[model samples]
Target: MSTTSPRRLHLNVNILHSGFVPSAWRLAHADPRAFVDVAHYVRVAQIAEAAKFDAVFLADNASIADQIDFRPITALEPTVLLASIAAATSHIGVIGTASTSYNEPYNIARRFATLDHVSGGRAGWNVVTTADLGSARNFGRDAVPVHAERYACADEFTSVVKALWNSWEDDAFVGDKTAGRFIDTSKVHPIEHRGEWFSVAGALNLPRSPQGHPVLIQAGGSADGRDLAARHAEAVFSASQSFDESASYARDLKSRAAAYGRGPNAIRVLPGLTTIIGATEADALRRRDELIDLIPWSYSLTRLAGTLGVPADTLKLDERLPDNLPLPGGGNGNHTFFHATLAQARTHGYTARQLIRALAGGGGHRVIVGTPEQIADDIEHWFNGGAADGFNLMPDALPDGLQDFVDGVVPILRRRGLFRSDYDGSTLREHFGLQRPVNPHARMETPVVAA
Candidate 1:
């Protein structure tokens, strides 16, 4: 909402294995084995860096959440892969998803802090709470935590990690050989925190990270999720099927952030966007149809049913979705994708088959099919309309699909002066036009000798 400076759009690519389309791995040029290939992710990151993208994001899963028999899964661990990516690319920031529901705060704090150090401050942590049954079973739990319980823990978990990050003041490390002092002990403070979900006595193991705290990102659409994002997230990955929905979400989130004593611009709302590009509208339509057609009707129907929390048997390809669908897992499963997918179906009154095609054989996120000019125009309209700060792009396919976007749409955005053409700073914070947080502990304890 601040008008002192020209608004700049931010972009991050969700390196979703082969692509957003489920059948993208079937593409002739795509490597079917790319899901676990480190080189593949590195290649995508390098291309994004070339396009001057703000970051390349990776979504994580503790267990194989997808139907891996028919498709590739998110196989590699995020932070480790991101470290490899950071080694391969210089400018593009690396953001990785880690679930707060399962992880202890200290380890996450240490892991990302190390990434920021090695990447020269180009790291972000996307905090998510695991919601699926497989992940729960893998973690030795019989059932997924209730929606409120998971978010409550996540809120506390994030706060504890932040406190640990702030435990050491910026000037805590001092290598004064003459003074025989390797550290300014007084500058390091312990956060003696005891809370319902976590307890830690601490100063972090490492010095303050390059960006103070690596950029905090969150993704969720439920009320608890929104409150968590408003309370702690620096940026959010969102799912809304339409521009008006995205605008409404943005306003609500910013309002919540304001209520928490944060500035309206404190949190960036980035909706999930899937693009299927071609030389023209007809060409793009052909490609979308081709990809969707590759997917078996069974797979799309099953996926849709899962998101809607309905039995796959209940879905008929030619029939419209059943009315009065309940929230997945008794209101505890993923709310973002569920709502987004349902909104798309209801808004268009699409049958199961139509819904599947609209979503490109997968579930959730908005899909755009067209030429570079059209994609650029849509992105412009959303950004200029305050519908989104930008998008977390999931192209129809990877490396190749991203190449199309960078080579095509990026130039148009650059021409309009809506996005950056080159890296202006080494840190992710600088890339996003965000400021490094001042350590509250440092500020509070700075002695004021009477002037």
Candidate 2:
């Protein structure tokens, strides 16, 4: 082993519609019905592990949206998919998205803890607030809650989850055969959390997870979102279209973290990335055009309208966006993607057709098209250039696209010492080199309000 620790690169494969390309499913080789199939997801996760990736992450939404008619949605519950993934692979970390807004803390706490145990500590929870009026409707609400209140609920929600995770001390499990004892009951405590949003009466039903608590990840970029991440989140999934914007976001978030008595390194920001791979520059361009050509113009228009909160019929493909475009009313929709898409259009002064073509299937994440070597080069440039700490890889097509990334780009990354060649530890936290979180009681001071 080298005495000097290598500069590790964290790569997470994000399973999006066979792959990240908007028309990936429409490809002749792509499976249109794969989204609901558990085995399809498991096979993808297995490929990621074989490539030595840090984890396979699944994004989620609680309700069906307008785009479901045109494209597949992530309809499976993340915990369920991750459990299946855990069974199929032993070393890869499984990260699942769960909306704090719609879920109860106690249930979430127990669910993730069980996942961690089942996966041998290779589980992580991506905390999100399902931000769409459509989701609210499914939950029997007329409208989405405001940003501030949603975050307030998230803050209280995560607190309860953490407390429940710590209810059982490390030594609480004492399976002594001779003594006929299974556990030390006194070591297990109840968390009586009565907060403005939720109340949890007591301890989690399961024992403490192998990694203490599954890693807490957050992915909102609003002001309120950053504050919550600073105080609690270990990793954050972000979206920024340009390098300058990404650096600014990274700097601002890390700087803001200091106010919470946490250091800049306390939180890691990984931006969403969609890559289209080819053998050469010309090949890459051809490949991208192929994917774009597969998208139905009507589907793109409807999706764009919903994102901009505009009526679909009013948006003409050939026309420029009307001046003084309205901001989304009600805190509905995926805020990061909502903002990023608008920013992309505004930056390039794009017409409706241009914008639709550019976004094709990315949904709002940054999209990069290049050869395999070029793809690795772009990732290295961003990682070292302060644009990101790591990337959440969204392949443009399912198994084929991901396979190309793994077989071609992974070796380049290893050769350049940008990524790992083998497993370092069993748990997701260990793979990320993060320390197990110490319980809050050990660090609690009198709660101080933001001035």
Candidate 3:
């Protein structure tokens, strides 16, 4: 028998509106208004916490980027919704997406830092760049910024955010009655950051958060995106349909992180996995079919076209995707989803109709339809094989679908010694087996403040 300890798998349930399936809200049991309901999110989070899942994540959008006429888009501001989730549940970490494109470094830094404090260190920020013209217009831009420019801004934005997070030493706060000093001014230093995109004056107004810094999580799959993740993100939410793809992604990302002087295992890779479960294989297949059948062909086609960055009219339902399709919007469209969607279609020679079915009603993530045992096996294989550190699960439907997994798959994982049966730590960092960041400013005797 091997004496080495078993690898611990992480699981974070993405509290996507309704579910991963666009038609999920139309289900008899689902509430169409759940996207805006704080209670719905709270309840979903509670379920995850009960099962000892590592975290509960929220994907955000600045504008209505989905087929809002037929489905619920990601409407609620993630940090606010996640704050509600944190209040209701005690154990699950709350990670929310906030784009660097529209917001300033200081505000984003302070918002998440405050969230970290409020959640007792269970908050994480999923860094993203706005790639849609709709979102750009929301921020008063007629068009999206170039891809390289966005990533460059993200790198600097992240750097400045980090510097601010570390500006105040851990012991900066010293409330001693005798000394009559609430804080040591010397311990708090200014970041004094000036970059191509942003210029910020000294230290943040607040001290460092409970996790030292809330865990930095990112979700991007392009070359530039990977470099951003490797340089700054502690964990990455990936979109890989197959084990080989995920393995290749993990290897490349870790190597990039290593080049930045971080450990090879520094970044945890968690791919998106949408689950549609049933007691039997046939039942699961039927469930998937039902969900697919519920969605209008028009909705799926438009959504698929959007992912591919092509016009809906460009695709014929029965034909394969056109070869050598250039990057959309003159190569400024969302590169990650574009490539991922194209790969799935090309690999299987799936026509537009078949691709729609394969993507589970036209989204760009891996979908699985199976019994609890079958799902567990897939999860186990990925975790043990180093293809993924864990998964950001998107169930077919909310509450019920998530509840099914907790009841069925979690038990199997525990039995196999692949997942945690209970909470071993309270902070998000602990849940992911990461350490709290040390305040680099502490090492310096004095830090300069920008005038």
lDDT for residue 397 in candidate 3, whole number 0-100 = 92
Q: Rank the candidates by TM-score, best first.
A: 1, 3, 2
The prediction achieving the highest lDDT against the true structure is 1
Q: How high is each candidate's TM-score?
A: 0.97, 0.94, 0.97
Q: In terms of TM-score, how similar is model 3 to the real structure?
A: 0.97
- Over the stretch 175-261, how does candidate 2's per-residue lDDT look in tens digits? 999999999888788898887988788888988899989998899888888888888888889998888889999888888888889
lDDT winner, 1 or 2: 1
Q: Which digits, one per residue and each the tens of the lDDT, describe model 1 over residues 1-451?
A: 7668678899999999999999999988889999999999999999999888999999998998888889999999999999999999888899999998778899999999999999989999999999999999998999999999999999999999999888889988999999899988788888899999888998888999988989999999999999999999999999999999999999999999999999988998899999999999999999999999889888888899899989999999999999999899889899999999999999999999999999998779999999999999999999999999989999999988899999999999999999987888988998888879989876565778998
The C-alpha stretches of model 2 lying farther than 4 A from their native spots are: 1-4, 330-333, 440-451
What Cα-based lDDT does every candidate model obtain? Answer: 0.93, 0.85, 0.91
lDDT per residue as tens, model 3, 1-451? 8985556999999988898999999999889999888999999999999999999999888888988789988888898888888888887999999999999999999999999989999999999998999999998999899999999999999999999889899999999999788999989998888789999996899988999999999999989999999999999999998899999999999999999999977899999999989999999999999999999999999998898888999989999999899988888888877888888998999999999888888578998899999999999999989999999999999989999999999999999998998898899999998978877776655878899
RMSD to the native, candidate 1? 1.8
Off by more than 4 A, model 1: 1-3, 444-451
RMSD of each: 1.8, 4.7, 4.0
Model 1 lDDT, residue 329, Cα: 88
